[model samples]
Target: MIGFTLLIALVGAERIAELTVARRNRSWALSRGGVEYGRGHYPGIAAAHAGLLGGALLEAWLLDRPFIPALGWPMLGLAVLAQGLRWWCIATLGRRWNTRVIIVPDLPLVARGPYRRLRHPNYVAVVAEGIALPLVHTCWITALLFTIVNLGLLRTRIRIENTALRQAADTTPASP
Candidate 1:
């Protein structure tokens, strides 16, 4: 259980590092006259993520859920998949991908990589991991709580991201 807690902490830290980089990138982009849209809920989104992660660990221990070997492999796979998609999103967006909402006018919306498929592939991966990772050890409380919270968060998040994308598209001048 201690190990699980530590693991969650490490994973959370990695995510925080990503956010830091993304924020720095966002700052650079904004300084160069980059457009920003739908940024009001960024802190809320971050808080929710952090809360879910902490809740997962707390529920796991509080509920005294024991790790079940049978579910471990699949859960590990899902976690790996989530991390892969997340990095793919980071790479695909390059400097444009930040934790905060940012859109640069006249720049084309990204359509390569994961964006080529689902409009928000990263979120898809996140949703999957949110459930699977906690269920790995039969931490039902964690799984249920995070899923419910994430659903609410994603609802608003997707709308904001999509709106930004559409705005970016509408503002961009048509190519000759």
Candidate 2:
């Protein structure tokens, strides 16, 4: 349980790091005329993520969720892999990477890194981590609820981002 708690704390720290990066990137993007989309859902996204970490701790401690070695080890690996993928997406996007959909016109969609194969690799990391993190300590309830909430959030999020991308592309003038 002590180890699991530390793991969650580490994940929380990682989330803080991501938000700090996102804040800096958001400012950079906006300064260069980046238009943000889907601001409304950002709060829900933050809440759901916070809930994931908190719920896992509460459920594991209060409900006495035991760590099954077979499940825990594999889930831990997946969580770590998800973290790697998340960072890859961040590095690939660089200053353009943000928690909110902020598109700079005339900039073509990223084609390198994980973006080459996955349209939304960051979300892939989010989904994978959400599941694997909770399941690490057998917090099945948190895993289930968080997954359900994220699916709804992602559906809206994806639609807004695609529309924003299309609009930005249309607004950008074609090269001579």
Candidate 3:
């Protein structure tokens, strides 16, 4: 349980680090005329993610969730892999990667790395990690709740991103 608690804490720290990177990326994009979309739902996204982190720990400890070695080991590996995928998305997008949907004007769509294969690979990581992380400690309640809320959030987020990207693409001049 102590180690599991530490693992949750580390995940929390990693989220904070991601926010720091997001903040920097947001600044860089906005400096170059990036337009932000769906600002209203950003708070909901943040709150839900924070709840996911907290709920996982609380449920595991309070509910006396058992760390089944079979489930825990595989889930831990998946969570780690998800983190790697998330970072790959970030590195692929460079300064354009942000937690918020901020699209810089006049830039062509990124068609490399994970983006080449999926329209939203980062969300794939998010979805995977959300479930896998909690299940690591058999926090099924957290896993289920977070996944339900996350799906709703992802729906709204993807719509806004697609609309924003579509608009940006329309205004950007075509290359000869």
Candidate 4:
């Protein structure tokens, strides 16, 4: 249960970072008349994430799982890594990156840092944390459920964001 609580705290901090940076980005985009899509699914995504923590706690308690201190410690380390990469993504994009798919035409595409390697490094962090954090205590159910639901969500989300990004690129002038 202690492990579970720490996991929740870690996730909570990630959310705080996203909200702080992403919200600012969102607001900046909004000021430029950017269009947003897929706001309706955000609540579902939040609920699914909350379920990840709940499921982890339930499995830890019902199964009498002995928390491996060694694994738990390392998992926290991975969680930190994921968080760092996620925020790096935000910082790289500055006001162009957002939690929501906000597309402002005539804006430049972000192509630095993690964005240079992958278009969606933030999502990479998300996938890593979803599986790695739950496995800290050997909670397979939490990891599995989170992966399944989040993958489905990401499939839809990625399509939408990619479309928006492509549109933004077509309308905006390329940087040298």
**Best model per lDDT:** 2
Residue pairs with colliding backbones in model 3 are none
* Per-prediction TM-score: 0.92, 0.98, 0.98, 0.87
Q: Which stretches of candidate 2 lie over 4 Å from their true place?
A: none
How far residue 118's Cα lies from its native spot in candidate 4, in Å, is 1.0
**Residue 19 CA displacement from its true place in model 3, Å:** 0.7
Q: Each candidate's lDDT (Cα)?
A: 0.80, 0.96, 0.95, 0.82
Write the residue-wise lDDT of candidate 1 on 1-176 in tens digits.
Answer: 87677768777887888988888888878986787766777777777778767777877888888888788668867877888898899899888888777886677878999999878888987898888777766777777877887898888888888887887778778999
Report residue 36 deviation for candidate 3 (angstroms).
Answer: 0.6
lDDT of 3 by residue, 54-97 (tens): 99999989999999999999999999999999999999999999
Better of 1 and 2 by lDDT: 2
Model 1 misplaced stretches (Cα beyond 4 Å): none
Tens-digit lDDT track of model 2 for 26-100? 999988888999999999999999999999999999999999999999999999999999999999999999989
Give the lowest summed-lDDT range of ten residues in model 3. Answer: 1-10
Candidate 3 C-alpha error for residue 46, in Å:
0.7
Q: For candidate 4, report its TM-score.
A: 0.87
- lDDT for predicted candidate 1 compared with the true structure: 0.80
